[model samples]
Target chain A: MATTALSSPAASGAAAAPEGAMVGGDRKWALRWAYFFLCLFAAFALMPPLYMLITGLKKSSEISAATNPWWVYHPTLGNFVELLTSRAFQIFFLNSSIVAVLVVAITMAISIPAAFALSRMKFWGSGILATGVFLTYLIPETLLFIPLFKMFATFRDWTGIELINRWYVLLLLYPTLTVPFATWIMIGYFASIPRELDEAALIDGASWTQTLTKIFVPVALPGIIAATIFAFTVAWAQFLYPLAFTTSEDQLVLSVGIATTLIRADVFNWGQIMAGALLGAAPPLIIYAFLMDYYIAGLTAGATKG
Target chain B: MANIAVRDRAAFATTSRPRGSAREFFRQKSTVAFFFTLPLILLIAILVIYPAFYSVYLAMLSKRMDRFVGWSNFTFLFTRETFWMVVKQSCIFAITAVIFKAIIGFIVAHLVHAIPNEGQRKWRGMLLVPWVIPPALSTLAWLWLFDPSYSAFNYVIVALGGDPIPWTGHALWARFSVILVNIWIGAPFFMIMYLAALKSVPAELYEVAAIDGATWLQKLWYITLPMMRNIIAITTLFSLIVTFANFDIVRILTAGGPIDQTHVFATWAFKLGIEGGDIPLGASISLFMVPILTVAAIFILRDINKRGERI
Candidate 1:
């Protein structure tokens, strides 16, 4: 599979010509059609973010003006500047960063060890537990948010400690969205590591903890990175949990903050809203750009490797 | 070191101690594994499992939650015209969206697979941009593009002398708009997954098929589809659950607007449960997702188990 993935289609096309000129010709046409559809799909896929960039650069005056919404007449960084300087937007950014970072920490702390155990320890019920983790990952937060909302509210009533409408509450809620998948990813990675490596470490008088930390973690660094990226992205981009759990301007994360607070009733700030949305989307996009391979590997690994 | 000492003790205990003794039990792999997994177990129980059961319990309660009212919220939903619309719309949204995403993903995956390997990465990167952005943020972009007055798409249509689309003003268009945005965000995921699946298909099979004079369609029908059946099924099932329970795209794009014609299970549940302060009704509405999700989950588990056995 790796060899095939690395081999160029042109090489394959050339190789097929020995079979028949008709086959080679068919391959050429297929390549041409492939490029055509690929370009079309690329345009469709890129249109929204491209539009967001275009609209974000415009002035509010120009946005309201009767001009081409596709092209900005006066492209300015005013919207970006305004949002960057705005206290509410700053608060949103800070909240999102804190929540995402902390959630990533907590998710890794829980999932890595759990995944190590489930994959390596050969414990009773470990197989069932691994499957259960995957199933938990499948449970959509939308299904849980309403009941969780009530649960938080009831906790407030019972203990007089409010969990809802607080930014910190997201630290708790986002894990429900992130940890199971992270664990599943880690389990896949750890399971793929040969048992002989850990067995060697165990024979050398290494404790299970020492072997896990010294041998497994280093070898599975790519999977750990992938899981960390997955966890961070999920926590950062989480909309439902934050939107349900936090409502106040100060409490809201970027996804909920930019979606809700940026547009007041009956009045839309298109430029700043687009700017905020773009900025809100920037961290994950940046991470994805730098670590594109790991990101895609983690994503496909969940299903294909499962 | 403490670690070496612990390891030594463990070795000694295993060698000399009775199997079921307290110290040996503590040193057992199962016990250590149980401790390692305890945090995960607790988190799932407290957050996921508890809320899942609580959602059912919430669904059974009266609107104000002061009294037990078994199945009445669901019964009330059954009587409401809006509830039925929501159910139909949710089904249409999920089913139509998943079908389109899977088809588009398959086609694009094949296209990407057909291209030269050097160009594949660039095309794949560009094609996956939609899936990379946070859906809420990207949906905001779509929301702007679908704005009733200042639609960029309308600008192009009007420039070409065609009628400007309502986009979100009309009911059908609102539904179309939400689903379009959904496909835009979701289709790339399918593309990525299918591309990965495509790569895993052995090229030798295709070579053999070509040698046997199989047409491209025959190759796809027999080789590609059969090889990718598990991934295709798993991705579709996963996307079905997600699209059925989707909140971001519909919530941001349409907000169940145009007279609630576009509300899926998630957004409608949010509307009734959160915004409307009818938690029981909302929970009841959200509970409707379970039957379909469970069915999909069962299929997914079976496929996964089958794959496990094969491996």
Candidate 2:
């Protein structure tokens, strides 16, 4: 849900334990029940993605109706290998990569300065504009895709240049998706910096641009990373936009492309679907695995602080 | 020397005129700020503002991207059985999913909050895996699990000496499956947010309640819920908007199928606008989503502005 973005990064310190705390009596029982529930939910949380890994490694012959779908016996990399080698799969991966990276870059470029202006440099209507930005972030592709589809159609009719069915056209649309949240996250981050930091620079004869580049950007590197991660994930995971905008085989991004290209005519290639899904999810998953704290921080930052 | 001093004072006033005068509309460094935000404002204008009004305009036109048909597309949709079905399905889908997500998130956050802080991070991280993964990719995995013939769930059911239910085969089951996936993907977020909120609920209150022999349910209802009321409202309202607009899980899982039983405004709009080639019809369907979202946004921004007051 787009409300997913409205959350500001929650502070890790919220869970800080009391010094020299002791557990006693019936509370131990409560702790045990807590762990029990925790394990239950963790299993529920983990099962599907874990199943994807198991299913991805299995061969088509092994994924039959009779076989145990839970266990991957005699696992093969055949699905992964086939998908990785396929040109269509590669194009999907490539388009997704291109779009995600470009979106992140553009998102950061626009968001950092904009966040600086909103958070650091006060201006007329900045308060209203900041709220407007957050409001824009809430506008999901569901509402936009129908209109976007028409807009693109109208565009082609007027300009004689096709906007749909092209990979690069996504570059134009993705900034809208990423920039708002990225700016929101950066605003939270920039606001956390003491006003003195910038004011001191101003007194030292530094310009606003110099203060931002020389100070805020470097100081808020973690926030930048957080925003970048969020943007990449959004761009990569987005399905409806690509589905509506790009229908052709070569032009499709991974999410829409996999759904359309692989899941054809009821002859479901379960192995390939799982494999492609895993492969497609790999970038964002890997990014989360490494920089999870930043990702979590960026998500909650808006809700908590913004 | 006195005249020169007065002249210097006057010169200083001139230098500070922008800040001192009533006419300093843009304020200090506003020029730099404007340049900084120009790209972002332009992007919102082009992609968001332009498209929004254009879609409304498009919805008025015929499918050929020509002619001013006024409210005919909306009228035409109102006449169709499928449109009403979609509206009903969307309401049921969003309301049910958000309610479940909130309740589940609260319970999980409480459980996570109960345990010692040492092990909480690991559990929180593990619990958040669903929220972290792409909804589209994860839905593929769900589809596999719901594969009627090859379902792992059916495998477990068979192993337990029971019949395998049609997971996505029947309309009822398909609706249930989509909502299940929606909850599975969304609830962890509620957990994370609620957990953060739970953390912010001062421990001293809980300790005092415990000293007074308060029951857990009493503490939750009287203390926890009240403390978390603002967050609960904002999060729920926000989630409602997102769930109403949800496309990936439904599209991936059911594609608004089984006789259009699961068609939310999103997938239904996509089907009509893009796939069905009735772009005007699709725009009309999707535009129906705006009023609810506008209401939600107003509530969120107002709440956030109030929070800004406290800061």
lDDT of each: 0.90, 0.86
Q: How close to the true structure is residue A265 of candidate 1, measured as C-alpha lDDT?
A: 59
Measured by TM-score, the strongest candidate is 1
TM-score of each: 0.94, 0.91
Worst 10 residues of 1 chain A by lDDT: A8-17
User: Which ranges of candidate 2 are over 4 A from the true structure?
Assistant: A1-23, B1-28
The RMSD of every model to the true structure, in order and in angstroms, is 4.1, 7.7
Q: Mind giving the per-residue lDDT tens digits that candidate 2 earns over B1-311?
A: 78667766775675576565643433347667898999999999989988999888989998886699999999999999999999999999999999999999999999998888998888888898898888999999999899878889988999999999888889999999999999999999888888888888888998899899898899988899988887887788889989999999999888888889889999988888888988888899999999989998899887777766767
Per-residue lDDT of A68 in model 1: 89
lDDT score, candidate 1: 0.90
| Clashing residue pairs in candidate 1 (N, C-alpha, C atoms within 3 angstroms) | none
